[model samples]
Target: MTDDIDPDEELMLAAEYALGLLAPEEAAAFEQLMARDADFREEYEAWAENLADLTDDIAPVTPPPALLNQIRAAAFGTAAVAAPQPEEVEPPATAPVFETATAQGRGLLQRLGLLPAVGGGLLAALVALWVIDATIGPSLALPTATATLVSEDESLVVEIAYTDDGEWLEFNRRTGRAPEGQDLQLWLINGDRAPISLGVLPAAQTGQLRVPEDYRQLLHGGNCAISVEPLGGSPTGAPTGEVVAIAPIVWET
Candidate 1:
């Protein structure tokens, strides 16, 4: 392969293939070469193995006390304490109103408290590539990956997290929603693969959706998107309307 193709260009193609940055036709051509050429196959695998190592360096961030309390409340159905009467003194601001949640949801929140909007896009893309190329083990008990999908016009922002063990995904709509007559549908995109419907997002600010068994593995380095569709959802099986928001699914920790 290097004899006909420039060695530098060959390596670059291998890296791009490993990252899933190539278009469908391009990826298909590359895969054909890999099937016929042992050297090219080794080169692509090397890049894939190196990319998967990125997950090892991720570290979780600790949220502020108040924010932690809110996460706990959302994870569990813990109600906020009632306000003090006018005649009575209020409790200290730092005091906890609800017991800390030790459930799986809380575990996911702890790792996902401070994900940046810009960071991890590449990591997520590369991780998706790694997932496609490598054999990943079973899902973890708690998910640490998350994505914040924002529209180009900044009209919408949705936070997404997936729990492979539970086979469910949690979404928190921080801002924006469908127009009065429309509903927002969620789609999961993995590399050059076709987008899979996660279904219409709930109107509620926070909710969970059960994921099908096959689609669970695709969430790690995939992307979640929200598109404006008809009242119930897309009439077509696929997205026929404009995609309003999109973001890469990434590790929070």
Candidate 2:
């Protein structure tokens, strides 16, 4: 697909995506094209993470006991299922009774943590090789789910990702590959009333920003947006830009 993106259009889309606010079809379309349009992805990621962070600030009130139980039931189900059994483990053999000189070495070996470690090392290597071959060979593409973030101008890209998991949305203002003086900021919009401030995303070249486990609900449902604001961001809570990219979080199969 043609990437034909303007900084402003992409930014609004990024916010919607980060807010977990996009309709399923819109999100899928973005994800399918993001690789070719990474600028879009990057901005979206930052916005989503930013908003996801704001929701993080509000404490998730504990659902009452009954509600908690109900949630668990809905999540886990009441169907009868067989329990998983533990794998049988063989016990180690008793140490050898050897000559005096050999006995001393064996005694030392037992004292050190080497005997079991050697066997474990071989087992670990085998597992590692198996995992690498299985996971690496398939060439699994980035997730169909995509996230997009934006700068205040709504065009300068910041970060993006392909998962609802907050890892992709964390890139803050490290450096701007865009025009001069434009840095990325993050925000959470209710899409109902207005947007709320989360905080500056982490700088570039850093790892994923942790999703505040606390405000997870916002990531699941809300119209999130990224706007082009000042270098620092809005002094007020409302958005202040051309809205470069946006993505709305919606339920998808």
Candidate 3:
């Protein structure tokens, strides 16, 4: 593809390359183009950064031995051989003087009747601290809300949750289908404020939307609406098409 590609197409290509969905030949061609075009390279790097951030929370895992061997064989034309086990070795014996000193120290504490008290106090303090921590510590939780948008005989379920990063909305269920050459757009309607566009819904029955931080507060006890708009989205910064569904956001306790 030429460097003067459409923005959406360029973004899609960058996403595909970052996700490793591109074929080897396509990846090679993309890499060549990226090397030649600074802007293309920047776009690809941005996609890579975003992909990395999205997956940063996932824990790393080691492959099973059988799977690893199969991968090795596929890549190198030979299965990986297991390394020989190392022989167990005995640890060095402790010096008698160190043991004697430790025993003397323990005997001195016990004779003074302080060892038991100290140990018990330390254990109790640790347990109390643990209890306090468990009871009062801030938990990693998000505030969530749900709403059901209904119009006539059709109904759709939507959920909103506030996270540290931003607010997210999930279309758990959608009943209406957008007409051909048109798309369904989700809008956030705060009390008397102008409707804020979330984004276009995918064709699937369920999808997610990220609400910008500035618009997150609007989702609390507000209303969510769906409207039919152009393929891309509403062009007039407002819904021009017919509103299909409207639901009140119910905050979760």
* Winner by lDDT: 1
TM-score of each: 0.46, 0.33, 0.41
Global Cα lDDT for candidate 2 = 0.41
Predicted model with the maximum TM-score:
1
Q: What local distance difference test score does each model get?
A: 0.61, 0.41, 0.53
Per-residue lDDT of 116-229 in model 3, one digit per residue for the tens?
111232234323422332233123354345555544343333333334345567775545577889988888765445678989887788767888888876665455667779
What ranges in model 2 sit over 4 Å off? 1-145, 149-179, 203-206, 210-214, 250-253
> What shift in Å separates residue 1 of candidate 2 from its native position after superposition?
46
Clashing pairs for predicted structure model 1, backbone only: 59-253
**Candidate 1, residues 1-253: lDDT per residue as tens digits?**
5568545876678788777776433543454355456688789779878997987888877655565444443443334335323233333456443223221222111223322222243235334433422222224445455767766555677877765456778899988899999999998766445668899999999999888988877776566767789989999867767776655565432
**TM-score pick, better of 2 and 3:** 3
Candidates in descending TM-score order:
1, 3, 2
Q: Candidate 2: worst 10 consecutive residues by lDDT?
A: 100-109
Which stretches of model 3 miss by more than 4 angstroms?
1-142, 155-166
- Name the TM-score of candidate 3: 0.41
